[model samples]
Target: MVASIKSAGKLSESSIRSQDDLEKVVEQEQPKKKWRWRVDTSDAPKEIFNRTLYLSILVFGVLGSARGYDEGNISGTLAQVSFKKTFGLSDPHKSKDEVANLKSNIAAMVQLGSIGGSLLAMYTVDRLGRIRALQQVCIIWIIAAIIQITSKNVGQLYAGRLIEGFAIGQTTTIGPLYTAEVAPPQIRGMCGCIFAGAVYFGIMMGYFANYGTALHMLNTSQVQWIAPTSIKIVLAGLIFIGSFLLCVESPRWLVKVGKVELAAQNLSKIRHLPPDHPYIVGEVADINELIAIEQEAISGSGVFDKIREILTVKSVRYRFFAVATMSQLLGQWSGANAVTIYSPELMGFAGYKGVERLKMTAVLGVVKFISAYASAFFIIDFLGRRKALYTGITLQMISILFFAIFVTVVPNATEDVPLPLTASEDRAAKAALASLYLSGVGWTMGFNSIQYLLGSEIFPLRIRSFAQSAIMVLHFANQYGNSKALPKMLLSMHKFGAFYFFVGIMAISLFWAWFFVPEVAGRSLESMEDIFSLPWYMIGRKGAELCPDHSEVSKIHVNSSGHGNAYDGKLDYDEKTSVHHDEGNSLMVKDSNEKDLEKEVKK
Candidate 1:
């Protein structure tokens, strides 16, 4: 199969000009007695998995670790009496209002930086290239880390947090995007999971460092602030440098931007594929198909025209909506940032004070990271995207319900508001905090990792980065909303009110997933042409026969002639056939040219 695909390389000049004509002629022949699926790296040498793919995926994980360090370390560092004093947050017990306002400002402001970074990422990701984008974000993280380390007051800390947020947004957006484009399709989901797991690892590390740093403060004065956590700044800076030197560029991006030779070169370097390796050939073919699609779209010019082009593609438009909404909503619903940035105090409200609450936060981060790993390994193959998310979202909604029940109904049942500190009451407070941690566990496993992975997968190359960035920005916006709103809502309307709101949102999102989001498990980007043809009703409900059988191929060509020379196995504007397919059967295949033309116009 690989040999046949390789032999069918490079359309000739005459053949190229009359692709439509050639397709028509090719269609008349009863399809050969062969499978109709495209080739991915499934049968490539085990060496394909040797060092390069694993190392690259792992390096992507390191990116997550660096991110995790920053995410986790802040909570611990913020707990130190001296560290809080440096930011004028000392005596938080007496100045709770002032400290709370400042903390809120920090949380809200980081998202503002994320807004800028997210917008920048959308514009520069494709322009600067994925590796370069990641490198730049790394630089930002290092700078922000340094700024944070030297901060003198709440204002400087705010600046540093915002800067860090920007870097985080870009890293989150590009890291997974790069992983998806570069990793072997067989392990793509796993690679994505590695990145997510790395993040959790970082979060756990941050918590560990923070706990160690504040644990009895036994270190010398010069190293007091420089104990376990002081190394975090160095670790972050090192990750930035390492990724810049080590991470490979996405060959697909290189191909899309007309750097075919460079794309081929990068593909070889990253895969460690010898010249003429089957993987390289399959990759090149895949690249060529995407390039052709983009070229067709590029016939339009001018910035506005290009922007108009993006808005026109049905896939792009829908992806943009779904990704953006998911980015925002998932972060919020997962209750991660809310818990990480504010829950220390919230837990304090329930009486788990000092390093205890901080440790719990770290535990939650670990749960998130580990679960992401689980999702990465099993999501693509064992459970399709829909089932994983269905399970995940359902779990999160249930957890949030129980949490709200604890907050509103259970607390009332105890009749324990303002209760005296009996051992029984202390036990109850501890139980409540434990429940919140459990809620964090459920939300992180499903919503956090799946949303990032799915958002990156759903769009085509022509505008994937742009679409992803927009979605990520919206994710930050959602995070910001949750962070800001939850605290205020908790004060104003009580905890259950906030949880109930998330419950409603997650319920709607679950419905959206059941009905709208398609399952892309175990399928390559090219295979997505099948997904394009699927009706909304069939999405996530059943799998489509993406690769036609030899018999179906014969039928396709037999009924396909003179139906407009455009059908290259993609759907088109002719809605009568594509939209109204019979039940238990998928939508019709379409012409490559017509689909590209239509996608370009739609964008």
Candidate 2:
């Protein structure tokens, strides 16, 4: 394999001057073939999928469970009779509005704390590095969990939730960012989506935790709520330990801070290749070149200048709005978080009572978990990002709209209480329940995963941490507003009103995404600039088409004749093959074998 790679590298150095030259070489060497739609993983080297990489991703990805658990566990916790009594929410004197206010305050506190956490991460992610920053997040989370576990009053619990929110905010920014930085470009979408998938994993655990405690333990037992809240400590502990024992710092972050040699070493370590190998060298070169360009474009070394650059630079500013701001704002307002955070209550509205509500919530979690991974493993890369967003959001719109229509026509439940339904109302409630589950699936597939994925990948490295932090701030802020307002909205706006509102917001989201979101399925982080280089108005429509085709750069080829085979550093070989490294553009190509030739020529 080494000999074949060396020969391919030598041939590329001798003959491939540009992308055009590389394409011409491929065209000349390969036979024509037909086209078929599929997820392309041909560019990824098998070594990139080593145990270390998977372990590291798992370490960081599980951090999402913290966020998911908080979102999922809290509603069930709030519903526990012991918890409500302990928190003074079960007082007979309290009006429905008062109870709703208390619930909103409890739920929104974490989001409030998360806003500050996001701001804190802007500095920590860059100064401390991704792994170290996340370790700090775990420490804060453990402390907050301890506070919640020991709290004797609502004030104390609120304080703990606020502290926990601070940690979760940091995880939201850092986890996906680290995963995207470390993943090989070919499988980046699948790998990046892992963080989002883990969120549902956490949600499922939280729901089941609540369900188990509710089933086996008395509702009046404080342990019912406390047991579920304590899960946070275990998750935080695992992530903190794994950070030290399993994970490596992001090589891109290493490169950004003028540690190019260290970056290359880390990159090589992660890729499971020698540092001098053409593949590793070429990757490092791409990171270095992009960083150099970003630095040159800036006028100063201060944080303020970087912030200014994001605003002053047209492409960067546009990305800041189109990808960062809009994705978060639209996603949060689309009401997915409301469903996740209030699944039990929504299930109650759907006519499932008491423990059944918790069981239904758990089912929602399972559906979301499956859908999120389905998107990760099959949809995002298979359909491409834009299409996934389109498909997922469309599903959400249909589901939410169906839900709104059902609630509007039926009298099954109200914000203040659940009504005993007639047989038809009961059937309608089941359909509504199915719609919410569908919404969860759609949310997981669309904005739930894509929001995190885009925030992590779309920005330039120079602005990534800052941009992601900003996006998270927006994410939590929107979440806080929605969470704090949802109970009141359900009561005042009527149950169906909130769903209708979401339908409207989702409509706007669908159109905005159609005109603004670019397809970035298999593109490298370094090549993102080309996608954003077109004018703001043109980027959504033409960016994918106009960008240099880096998706195919990792293709490895072998011809039947065994002559003129091109290699892109990936180690697939039938015979001795030549590899080409277009260092200037970071383009790697392998000539086509009979099968690859037929596949390539069809396009």
Candidate 3:
């Protein structure tokens, strides 16, 4: 089944001038056949799993690790007495209430800056290219790390944190997008999922570094506390080096910009295929064809026009934006960040304190990172995105609800009250702690990974970077809100009220995902517009579509046997066989007049 669409732009502009073109445009469909299901990679050559592919995916993990280091390191920093005293956050002169407010500002400000970075990425990623975008963010991280290492006051620390956050937003935005674009269709989910896992890997790195730092510098010299901040420099430096040395620009972006020859070469280099290799040739042709239609639809003349095109067009609006935005919304409301960034303090409220609380925060970081790796390497491909998320969101909502209840009923539970050391209180705290970590399993495994994967898969070449940037910006906005709201809410509201609030939000998100999110696991990126052209309800349920038997092929007469004039087998993929078959299902016009039109244009 050829799933690639016709030259939609030409078909549209010249429809009235040619009858033969109209015949060529007729779409042929066979009745649904009983085809068996196999993985999409069956069509991919075994060379798909070679070193270049692994290195490419692992490098993005490097990007994620840098992000996680910043995100996870701070939780451990807060546990250090030296860190607090030097910053005046836990100064003797300050009231507990005052200190809490300061902590909230310092922690939440990072996310506020990330929202700005996400917004900026919308234009810069589309313009600068993915590799350059990553290089620029790496420099930002390096600068921020230096500021953090040299900081004396919370104000300076906040500045560094905000800069780091801004840089992180862009890395996370581009990491998965790049992953999805480069990976073979069969393993795309696994490769893309690694981006989230790498983030957790960074978190683990940050937390362990902080843990080590706290052991040595808990109450020592102010300069000693800078150890963990200094670590970001190393991780970001590695990414800076890798950005230039390890990666090629996304071929899809190259085609969108009219560099088709370069795009083909890059595709060959990345896929380890000869330029004329069927997959490479077919893909390059499809990219050119789809890009033409996308260019026709979305004008890059100005930012406003691109924005209007996405919002105004139904296929772009419902399939890409709506699904991407909702998934991001869940990422924010999943309640993972509350635990990841603020776990030490959050655990303190559950009666664990001092070094023990810090250790427990590291443990949660371990759980999160483990979940991320587990999902990245294994669960995502087998279970697919929808089931993983359904399982994840449902479990998380249950855990949060239980956590809220347990914390609320603990003896004399009150806003900003530290958990006491009594036996009964300790038991209650332990139970709440169990629920929290249990939810981490779901959060990291499902919400964290799938959101990034979905955002990367949904957009077209013409506007992918821009659309992804918008989605990331919106994602950070929610993260910023949660960052701002959680610190205070945990202190100001009923001890359990925040969890209950999260319960309501996650409950709504689960339902939204069930009805709206479609399965895109093995589908080619060039075929997304075709996927959305059909009714939304039919998207996932219609498995690999089968092409008509070879018997049906001989009767048809073809005009131009061009590369772009083919259907992507994904829409009509036969599940019984793993191969991706292209049926030349393009809209071709048959006329000397049309042919002469092309000739005259060339003259």
- Reference-based TM-score of each model: 0.77, 0.89, 0.82
| Predicted candidate 3 versus true structure: per-residue lDDT over 222-330, tens digit per residue | 6545877788888878877876677878888787676778887888888886675555665665666666666676546467876887788777787555588878876
Off by over 4 Å in 2: 1-38, 415-419, 550-603
Q: For candidate 2, what is the lDDT?
A: 0.82
lDDT of 1 by residue, 1-603 (tens): 211111223223433334454444444422344542322332334455666657666666667665566656665665667765666656636464566566566657767787788888876788898767777777777788777667667678788878888887787778788888887655666677677777777878777776666666643332444454456566666766766667777888887777777777788888786534434555565557555766776775444654675577665555555544654565466555666666556566555556786767667666676666666665544565667767877776776666666667444322314345467656766666666666655555566666667767767777667767777777777767776676677666665677687778788877777766666765566555456545545644553444331211111111222232212321112222222212222332332444343332223
Candidate 3: RMSD over Cα atoms? 9.8
At residue 367, candidate 3 shows an lDDT of 86
Ranking by TM-score: 2, 3, 1
Q: After superposition, how far is residue 202 of candidate 2 from its true place, in Å?
A: 1.0
lDDT of 2 by residue, 511-576 (tens): 888889898877888888888888888788788888754522243333433443334323443234
TM-score of 1: 0.77
Q: Specify the poorest-scoring 10-residue window by lDDT in model 2.
A: 569-578
RMSD of each: 11.2, 5.5, 9.8
State, as a TM-score between 0 and 1, how close model 3 is to the true structure: 0.82
Against the true structure, candidate 1 has what lDDT? Answer: 0.61
